[model samples]
Target: MPAKKNTADKKISKTVKKDIPQLYSPLLKTYFSDLTSANMIYTKIVRSPITKGRIKSLTLEDIPEGYFLFTAADFGEENYVETLDIQTEILASSEIYYKGQPIALLAGPVFTDLLDLEKNIKMEFEKDPASKIKEKEYPYAQRFIRNGKAQKPEEFTKLFSKKNYDIKGTWTSVLNAPSCNEANGAFCTFDKNILTISTPTQWPKHLQENIKRIFNLKTEEVFIRKTISSGPHTNTIWQNTVIAVMASLVAIKTGKTAQLVLSREEHFEYLIKKSPISIKIRSAVKKDGIIEAVQVLIELDSGYHNPFAAEILDRLVIAANNIYSVRNIEIIAKAYESYTPPVSFNIECIDSQAFFAIENQMQKICNVTGFLPDELRMKNFERKFSLPFTFTNEKVREAFSAIEKMYDVNRKFISYRMESKNRKIDIKNLHNFPLRGIGVACGFNGIGYFGSNIFACNQKMEATLESDGTLEIHALQPSASTLEVWKNTAAQILEIDPKQIKLNSIFDINEDLSVPENVYANVSVMTYLLKKCCQDIQSKRFRKPLPITSTKGFTSAQKKVWNKEKFSGSPFFLSSFGAVVLELEINPYTYKIYIKNVKAVLNAGKIGIPKIAENSVKLSIQHALTELVVDENLHCDQISVSFVQSDNDPTQIDGLISRILPAAFTSALSQATGHEINTIPVKPQHFFKEMISNENSVYSK
Candidate 1:
């Protein structure tokens, strides 16, 4: 780690991601398990059992001499952590919003004693039943329109009603259930007003800021040490703070170093999960296959409230009606509080369910218009995006063309359509023939934050070319692999050894190293910054003696100019386009869906490392397939990924496969089962509930 500063002066490097290997064979240290302190006491968080209620009283009994207990009553409301505004409570005060919400922290040298104390604690609650809970709809983040002049969603729908065909649908996207990974833990010692906190988290900078505010310490006083992260994009922003604060408080109160880690169960229960959204779309299309107007109602189960509700809703509208010519589109979305744990709309939140809904709707359109799925997509594909984006029409077109030529998606889709049209099932002879479906969906994910974000980002990144030709980048830690890409970017441009570029990730514990929730955003931003810095240094290398410096900064204001409601941006950065054709055969008897083949084509600018890019797409395919169906996971051998050569810098293409695969998977399912499939994660139960629900079914006919 180099010295601290994320600022890049005048010199940055050109962007290039080289194939790099990780430097590690050493024993990895667990964040908490490896932490050793003679007097450290283990801590556990006791939570609320009821979903919605007021905590009338909480009593702690037999808290022995060395044991400690802390609750919200012991702290001020101002001393809390949040995603942006206030969401998760450090400890519940009066009203409990969800089940398994933390209510108190119990700590002791003997872990078993803490557990015993928790068991002995008596609690009383005044519960509120389901009727009292309000889960209602609210306004959408923005009413976005692409490819045509903007008009009111309602008025456009009314005007188009005369000459248009209407397609309406409602689908639910459930939580992408996560397996528990031990639990979140922290070790803190308060000494000399400098609090040292060790924990595993993606957002260390945010954690430092939170601890500083809570303990009334300065920026440098609250320090964060690099502990092994549980995994990328798994740790919630608030959980780390909550756990750290509890540990820090124990240290302060006990006058000794404190250690607190949630059990596997506690960690799973307390941490925020991805938001589950339900989307309803109503579209009016012309007979010529032109989509005139669309009205969408999205209900998102955001646990309590979504601080990024507007952003999530806005992105949904763009994805649902993007890359096409839709005259007018309106989305009305709401974030409702539920009995479940809190959720997040973080960078990694792909909203596959929403994407699935839109593309599924497109395949359904193909059914009515006598056009194939890709035909309907091409009929509306934009020549050049009217909205401000980085990718070009040529690059987008090449990807589409390659996918069409390579797989002959149209021929296969048509051939499958012809073969599987109106097949009556013979229960006695179900083994004679198999059911297969072909699906295709196009996807484009824009990199970086939207104009209006949940928090005001005022992050500054600095890079200095030391007199010794040492390229030192000052910022928080990104993933090890991504950092290598950044180094290679700088090394290629600076004509310096890649090893000469060192990252000083610990300038302040709270620097946003970027969780790489969307590695494309981080890769693009840092690579661009490094490019500018290196180019500046090259101009001064001969003139100046040594140690040239470059600094770059970003403000929330830089992105605020994007008006998603109107589908416009001052300059939306980079975008990657992808087209996926998934062919699957579903078993009529067992309803098992098996992947026949998945072929994808993408244009993500340039590839510094083709194998890495290809692997990313494959992993995404596996993840999407794992989510789309519960049975017969597809092997990587069955998936083929090819890229379109682009002259521009490498942009993001990591999430393309997962983003659009759900839609295509379901589209294929729709064909195989001879049913109009709208919802994702098609499970075994769906066959019995919907397909076999009627006697006049494809399986029963």
Candidate 2:
């Protein structure tokens, strides 16, 4: 096959500008310029100073009798939110689980009136020492194991004992800072039973359900419209949903439009921040660097109740083995209830621990056996594609090969080590305050819910024939995915030019269409699935078999089958793989790290939109970088929780570098660094410091 021409080398024609409006100005403005109202005011509970306490007596004075107020009591007995049958109570009822738990919510007419009401409210509590889940006393939850028809609390000490090798180290990364924005009040109004609520929410469907249940209204009675979200990564999930529900409750009860806009301080305090996880790993490895057995214990200081703690822990265990052939792996993950708010940090925290353990262990085995890291990894790497496996061996090999070729990883490794040795001997200058050192790390995370999880969307695309023969594509969100699926599908069906098709705005909620928890993994796969379905429907409709405008639901039973031991192989229909090689220059004296450059490659099947796919990979890198470098921490009751601080801002859409098209297979970081990294947001400063402090570090071993 001939070499593909670079996108930059392609010649541009004047007709290209006239043909591609979507490539330029794609955002279509609507009548609703602004969704927020000025009348509503919002404030969160100024939590009690104590951690563990029971509400004894509560009193409120000098407030109008009819002013809207709500607490956990308002949810009633029937209202509940369930993910994979695990029900998570939205509001804290009688007893507060953590110090910053949402006890009650207040919303009303004037901002001053709400503040005055808050000052008058008083509560008395009885301290309970037994209720607190202290870190020092009880670090983990009681574990039960089924042994020959008997269930017993498993001993943690024995389960996690090191048999052949052991390593102890602490890994840390800075949470990217968050940007500050003017506080805007969220308002909802019920006009003729059409309840329209606007807020910054990522999971629109979940928020809609919670609000419907709170107001005791049918699904059609409520409408959730999302505002232009500021943060796309982790900011818009659980916390925002809860606030929107509270505000809607106030509006519905008073028979008038109610608004709840929180101040920036209140947003910071009440909102749940990411939990910092501390991990300890022990492993059994052979002389050849192949892992035999592994034991890991992860401690999550979940501020309050964590809904995704169990799932996150499970993923960490699965990821601990890395992309190696291993047997007899044992993982024990625990979530400790703390006085701080519930923690939902990025997936990188777990990746950091797992990668640190695996990569370090690999290096150790190589050093002991006098083998290169790459050779050891390749020897143990899985090389076959089969079912009933989480990841195919072929896919892994392809990714590694692609990355190695793109970056010339083997040469870089030799160069980096030689440079480090030379720097150590010829350091005479006092002006260079900080010594520069480079480190590398790698990470992988699943996007959608795993196993038997289901997500559905009621997507509708309409097309009208025009006399001028030019097609106009109207879609909910215009991009390559929507264009190919909706407009192109319509064009093919009607036997008209794809440019002549028009798409209408998306505005429908089908109760049948739902997404299971952990929808991120499904983003890329679902796009393809939806597009395929559209093509199938278009082809069938063009044959005069039936109308394409019909509702559809998709469910996969693969995860359940695999979990039950009835099947082996991938539980998902498709999987996306990405690898990154970061060259980090760390200032040893100041503990500061500079990312010299990053080379990343991703494989996600056939590229639908080359530009969009490349952008996604770049965005992922930026997201990981911020989480590793930016510092955002919350200190409460001596324990600290972190947030995505403002400095870790997302990569601007305008300043994107080159978007590389995927080859037959994606590349691996080893090709660039000569060392395999298996962690997310790999902090060079932390890794280098640990390497320097511990002479028996993985790099030296």
Candidate 3:
């Protein structure tokens, strides 16, 4: 059900009805999927069939007059687009990096005609003698921040050697591929060495730069406009560039307009996956249950090549424990390249999996020390282990307390914990027991603007007061839902009617950003930046001339506060805290898990549009639920979300639900099954294997 603005209605409920997407999205038809012209031609790529290899030999047939065939030879050897500083060939010239690497393009007026030509293109490959997977890890990051300065790994080594650690567990997660409804493609036409293309992308400036480097075109020569796309930002960040470049290549060489869109299967197959991570944590705790010394290992499988490996590894280490005081801690995180699809950050950022690993580790602490889940969490939640490492957690205790009282969390957990213990005592006849468990986890998300490409895209905002007293704003067009919110904000700030505000779509400035709508993670930051611009215009409306243009910079305060090198300081743009109480029950006969109820309390700051914010959080929770406990039979009876009423300023909230829900869901399932269930997407086969291997497994591994 779509949320109403009443606080009383925000309670737990059952559901089998799927959430419906907003019916109308402008981006779905911006370039218009119906785009077609008689002068347009379709292109099909000839791909390498092997995972790793070199092109040993090739043969080709003659192309008809209207059809065109091109290869790497058509472009120079130096032609390639580098994503995140890693160079990838536009078309595989000598060696293939992965299976389905494009080797050639065949274009024709008819799409079916091109398919026939691809069959006649003969190709031979020599498989690599060496293995594709390597034991080495690249771009490694290690940090041990303790006592106000960076410490060495040996400090934790000495502590662990003395048998002082009280809690230990290993958690691994696999990122499930997100579902996309619309296919991504581009329409391109290169005339007189100037290329004009319409496509959607997360990083527009990067795409322009890629085109300039490959085609040797000037900055002003390439013109980019938005197109039809509802895909995830993880793919659009780099994937759109590949399609645009291919279509442009065909258009320039054939002297015909070209439209290229990946088929649905191709889009999903080639799309980037979040790096699957395995986190191992060991902690030393006092008799009263305060964590003092800790050691963490993060084994991240960075599929193909990720430019942000260092950032991913660093964020994982920092989020090992949320808002806790760990006096002596050491972190070792290594990223290894693999043969699967490349890994990219999720729409919520890359911290979801890391938060899952640590929160579960915290639950492990609860089981051994006999401290209630919330008791251990709130006791040491606010204390800082070190000044440099302690980022602000806005309402860590408040959110948890709200959900605890709203859902009667303590009483239910005590009951479930007792039931879990009873089942293990009667472990031989587990089928007779009604398996039920509840999990509680608290975490915060603080992704800095620098963490995403919004800043690197050279994002700038402008507002002009027209001579007719109507305000005109030049900015990146936001999503349909947020567009109205932007207008209302500007109108209120200037005391002008919402009808008088005009938003101009920015395209191809050649120096700054023109990102596709909602591609960036932090919508609140974008709105905040726009709010600042409107405020400035409101301040100068009387003193300045009839029309004043504000070309001012809109960089966030985080750039000054964050230190990316040291991996400390206030690296997050703003922090939003959340606590989830998730209940799960298992079917004794089928071995399938279903969500019973979920109660979440969030300190999301002041919500701009309560309905939109509520719907967005619910959708994020649903997506994250698919990541951990996907089942056709799985239906959540209640997923209650309530905002903290204390904060005055608005913080980022839309994507934070996904960043925190997986941890709570996984923790709940682990307790319910009474095994070391530290994996994701809990399949039926996995449950059988887990039970068969460790029928005697307990919480204290």
Candidate 4:
């Protein structure tokens, strides 16, 4: 029997429904059972044990009846992985480049047989003296970027020859791996003429093109079905694509469905790790506390086969003097070859290193000149944007001020500075006293792919109006649903209830509309496209047929003109400004640092849902803090974060938070300990060792 409701109860229910806004989002699921054992066979990769070597011969102890072995010789096509660059080798035919380089693929109906075969496999190699993974001499390259007219070397040397305030510092960041929750895997099946591959990736279009070329198949013959995984950056996309291609190759050869799943250990062993970066900045500041010029030398360890080294250096140059106004600056960045596999991505590699050096230098200058960091930053903050993209001064200042107030940084910095100076004066017994310090860092991140000729600049986004008067968003990729914000944005433009807007997981259109790679940029761009599409649909709904559609590319104003040769131009669509304040307590006995609180302020333009935006920022800050302080065998760590919505500013708020927090955390710990610590994933022993060594040096001096 159906339950009955009174008139008052019905009225109350209607009132509650009207008050709460409705949101429609696709399911956020990363695990999928899309392929079953009946149709799919398990495959495992056999890798070279030596980092660099020439293959002598291969031998197999025993092979099962249904198991198959495939090597580079099996596929005659050039043994290289396809991407923006054609340099990375997929399989070692004659030589191995890295330790975990794939040597062969073994597939079988029973997964146990594949594992048994891998355990019993053996190889012989002639190890090259010059090709050792740890000792290889990587090719080197250098370039300089200057804002003013070009000066001869003699003239450049003369500017720094004066008896001025000279401060020299070196910042080094260790290898920080991307924390991937889901180990990468791929599934492939081939029909009569078409091939279907399922994998978790950011660049499905690139994968499809690479497989098509390798297999000598038509464009339509290859299909890429995306799996669900968030937080894997660019390296994951490339690594997983290689696995997908290998699976497709095996399936085509044996006429059996092939699947390859990288275990967690294999994911770490096989994929690229974040290359270490070292930066040295020498500044020539006038006695009057004005910075006249800066000479910066940056060395990045680009593991062997570093195709993206130039792009990484380009981003570093932009961040070298990011927020300050320095007219005359010389930056020399070099990419050195190393034995590890090449790694490059968004925050995990580039921006974090650049900003840490820049901001740490600012704090060091303040310590020398007796000027507050905030005061010095305000004095030197660049008011107008040049060389790089344009950003309003108010946006930067707003973010800076909000963080300062939220964290009580203004008062704490002064007290901490005085305490640090006193401790340095009598450092004989410094370990007896516990210390607390606060740090602040301000900067902005570019949205979308910028300054790179290899990445797509102009991509399209689609939005449609369904027959039932509902709006549907077709995204290029899947991510955590920020669709509440999108629905509200589209509903406001369409003059309809927010519940009527829906984001679709799949659409009946061609897969050419690959938006910018970053998730935050995708959300911001999709919202803009939805607004434009809603306007078009509203104008047509009265007279035109149902199910209208509209599409748009990034605006001319949003597109950046990049110069590949000279490496100059505005390379980003827009800048998302962020300021982070880290408050920490250092343990005197154990030399451990406890992160007490993390306060951050972001100038992400005009937030739609404040709670959702706040939660998103909190999640990223937590992740960064967990990676920074919590994971390093430390105890009692806590974090808090907030965002300030700027109606006047129009920048998106995606991965900017993750980029800014590491620098702030590092700077804070450096200030507290009175050590110039310039590194990532900072360890307590680094400072503990420094303190013990410095005590002896003080007596000798």
Candidate 5:
């Protein structure tokens, strides 16, 4: 990496330089700009129109002279989009599994002529009714169950029959377009068997390996440069690689630079979306509000052909029970391949559904036992921490108390229950007063990768120190904010100013660099490695060698042993506790639910950077709000968020506001409307149908 030039006339004092960080570095500004245009060819991907079918024939007889067409047959070897567990096809060869699947690549000089060529090209397909795909399935033998060792069907029936209250509900979460709307593009050029590509991605090493395998090139023959990215919480890394590989293939074939810019519509159609999930939960609880047993069945649609479906299912299974303690529980998680695009894992999207299911069950217990939502949560709160994944009950109770005190939860919950009862007795009386309700939810978000494998929980970093007292560090793709944290950490260890450090600004890590789900855990791993390097640098400061380098790898102990074959063990590394209280009102006439206010308390271990942690909490809440209630039809009238920092202990909170906010919001909506809401992206139509059904039952009585 070239050092950024100092264009200022006069240099600042060292003391002053330590206080001010260059927020926008020169290298960062130009990372996303189109770098190559001279002698470059534009390319577009031709896709399958049908959802699932077989191609009879494709015609390109009227193609222009300068244009080029490349299909799956053009590649030297078959390419598979790989994961730790499974592999899916990179390009369609014979059968197309889903709509918008890549069929062929077309490249030429003029964009309009390429469009005309696509219009002229025609294909015939034979559509099989059975081939109209529904969903792909993971193996049943890979399921994990706790305290559900009944082998006979009769014993299973007896288990459900002995409970005081048997309740069942299904929760569904649909696709949520991420906030990042910036268009994606890539450019590639080859010279002397060295392929250089520029693109913005979060998974560089994965792409490099894929390119090498596809083109039959060596690792040194391919070079990838970093670019500015909005870092949309989606599968853009894989989608961008598809574009990058396409460009590289064109450039190699034509002996010229190749580039492709996808339109916004194309981005949605081609990229994987957040898979829609359906969760059916059945539980038995005592009249005194104790959870006796629980059984949950979760099904998610992995669109098209994707091998990452198991990762999503594994996370849901881990979070199925949330933070509550139950004696007998059985969780069945299944991923079905559908016609839509495969949904990638975001922190919020992966764990939200399971949290919703568990929280919804708690609300139902309140309905049966005449307890407020907060009261029920407090009753069932786990005071003692579990092994392998330990949580501080003191922190959870403190946060829960703060939310209750800030929002006056207990009094409002009682008042709303009374008002709802009065309105239910006489529907006409509710016209003048909107239905009001308050709900609270508490849970912990697990950090690190989903499973508890020892090998998957390790990270590595390298650091070098120069004779001039400057410290240089090499890390896997770390974000700018993370780099700042690492620099400050090293400065503290070395007893020097942060300006004495030189660090790489790349934002791409190895695609499989297993760490916590959140960014802070990855930073912690880097910090641990840096600490060891600093110790080496300090010991050899004046002894012999001027420039010293140290490389180290850090791995946490496997506190919980997991059996992959049986799919049972402790799957969490560490967990951060959080609670949310949602206060809202509902229009009785229009059936529109308006969120009046939201008070949340997050207890992530310790505070390193309060501002960044606070911003993450706010963003998580905002994203969750949009996903649950603030869509095109529903509206949130008011919202407020507050953070309560834990005691200055060494522990860090895994960012978990996203998982907490949605569950609380949905529970509060159910209380406000006096209707059990099981699905997310709540709409008025669901309530309207419920209202009609209720009225008919009343008329019959």
Candidate 6:
């Protein structure tokens, strides 16, 4: 073997720059300008009409000769849309799996020209009239298995039997309404090969990959830049990206940058929405209110293909027990694929169901054996932390305690019940006016991707000591947190002023770096790693402990450090725990619900950037509320189901108020009046209306 390279010989004295003025950086201005311009023009798209049919003939007539057309045929057969390691034809080639699938793309010099041309395109399809697609056949793990033998059907069946449990409770939620009336898109051309495609997106890398694949070029040839838009929390991922890709392709093909915008009708009609779910739980409890076993089955109307059906099911299975210690647990999660658009994950709905099951069961046990819900929960709460199987952090517990104290949960519970008994709050208020009810939910979400899968990051940070003593830091990504890490680590190593250090452009992935483009759940972790590595390098350069920058990778080891899978420890590099309490009033007559106030307590490690952290939490709550109550729909292929109405906002029906309480508050609701809220978007009046009419309840808890 050849001799190993010498570290001492490789070391070089690189001079750093001083006070590099970045305030007027061209890249920054251009980036912002490009984003702004892209948002001005609206882009619209027309999709194929057939589902599960072949494109026998597609004719473009009575349109401009210069118009550009793109289809699955544009990209080579080797290129395909990939997700979760599964590759499928991007544009339907021989057949379409669902309606509204993109088969052909058209673009013109003007937006109207594109729309006019779309009206003229003629197509013929041979539909599988006898086909009846079933949803339950598609298992979440189906894509992960390469061969038919990876997992025997019996294994899944056995696992189901072994882990099964019962759940008993009712959960209700109200979607925080959505604003779909105003929807549009725009694009601009920076250069031939480099175009800054901007739209609402949750997964930037995935969109970038799709663009690269569609263009049939290397990943370096195309770049995707993200801009702040409405959260992609709902179904913006597929809808926005697909439309953007089609528009970008048109611009590239026509040799004139194009902008394809969508109307609100088109946006809702073509996109996917959240699926409504109903879970029935039954449990066996010990005399001490400890759960002996749980049995639960969830019915999810995923609409079309159930893209997130499997993941949702997996989460439900894991969440059945909550933080309480149970001897045996069993869960059955199933999805029903319908003609509607595919439903995405609704976190609030799932949490509500799980909490309702666990909490209601606690209440029932309390009634039978004489105990309080809180008393039982605390009695069975896990005292020790475990890996993948269990989640109970010290900070989470402290956060909960703080919230309880701030909210006076015990006092409220007693006071509310006494008041209700003494003077029954007019039940008519449930229908006629905004009725108020308080609710609290406490839980922690795992930070990284679920399971034992390895999460990889290829990050590098370069620091140069300038002749003027100022340090310039360059990184692969624009990590605001990583800049702090570099500052802290470098300060200790070089004994220099943190303010003197300046951070430069991040490695542009579209230009230089290459790695899988997926959302990094814990971006802070990456920054932390970079900081530690840079600090080590600086220390070694100054003749301190050890050597210069060090590169390290981690994988999920089999050893259980905390009595759980090792992967669980990775997120502990940092953790965030919080609780939310919502107060709502329902109008029984109008079937409306009004949010009165919200109190939340979050413990973020060290609070690196208070503003950003607070904003993130607030945004997360907003997104969750929209998903839980918004009047949205999804189809089979996991696209949004459209409606004839222009306004899709849920707030249109009634009064809605939202307030954010500090992290010092912690508490759950003691009681809620009106119809028993068992499902999300708790429209108690709607339920009462249906019940009074002797109709099946439209809302399921």
> How much lDDT does each candidate structure score?
0.66, 0.46, 0.69, 0.67, 0.65, 0.46
Worst 10 residues of 1 by lDDT: 1-10
lDDT of 1: 0.66
Q: What's the TM-score of each model vs. the native?
A: 0.87, 0.70, 0.88, 0.87, 0.85, 0.69
* lDDT by residue (tens digit), candidate 6, 1-701: 11111111111112223232212111222222234333233334557676666777776655555455566655546435555564545566766666776676665545677677777767777887524435457633321111111145453334333233333554332233455433535464535445556554545566666775666545444555444444333345444555666666555544455666555555555453454556666665655566555556666665555444555555555554556655444456666665444555443124444544444445445434544534666666774433235553344455556656666655655554444333243332233333344554444443333342222333333466665666666543344554565576566567779898776654345432332222232354444554555565665665643323355333335123222232233322222334555555444445454455555665434544445545555554554454443352211111111111121110000000111111001122224342234455433345445434532232221
For residues 1-701, could you state the per-residue lDDT of candidate 1 as single tens digits?
01111111221122222322211111125656568788787878788889888988887655567777777755666546766555556787888877777887777888887777788888888998743235454432334333345554455647456567888877666535454454677888766555677777556555766776766666556566646655343345546766888888777666667888776665555564565577888878788887777777777655555455566665665566556656565666566666667565444444555777788788888877778776677777663334333224355666777888888788878877765664534434445577778998877766655544533233446788997779898765666666877888788888999989998754423344433222322666666666777788888888988888877755446565665445465334567778888888867777767789999988888787788778878887887676665554545458899988877877767667767887887888888777776665566676656656653454454
**Predicted structure 5: clash tally:** 9
> What's model 3's TM-score?
0.88
Q: Of the candidates shown, which would achieve the greatest lDDT relative to the real structure?
A: 3
| Top candidate when judged by TM-score against the true structure | 3
Cα deviation of 574, candidate 2, in Å: 1.8
Better of 1 and 6 by lDDT: 1
Q: Give the TM-score of candidate 1.
A: 0.87
RMSD of each: 8.5, 13.9, 10.9, 11.3, 8.8, 12.6
lDDT of candidate 6 vs native?
0.46
- Judged by whole-model lDDT over C-alpha atoms, candidate 2 comes out at 0.46
Runs in model 4 lying further than 4 Å from the true structure: 1-34, 119-122, 131-143, 175-180, 347-349, 383-393, 402-408, 427-433, 477-481, 507-510, 514-521, 539-547, 560-566, 629-645, 692-701
lDDT of 3 at 466: 92
Q: What tens-digit string does per-residue lDDT give for candidate 5 at 109-203?
A: 88777888887666777876643346244432234565544445465545666546787888887646454545676778775566777777555
Error of 2 at 518 (Å): 8.4
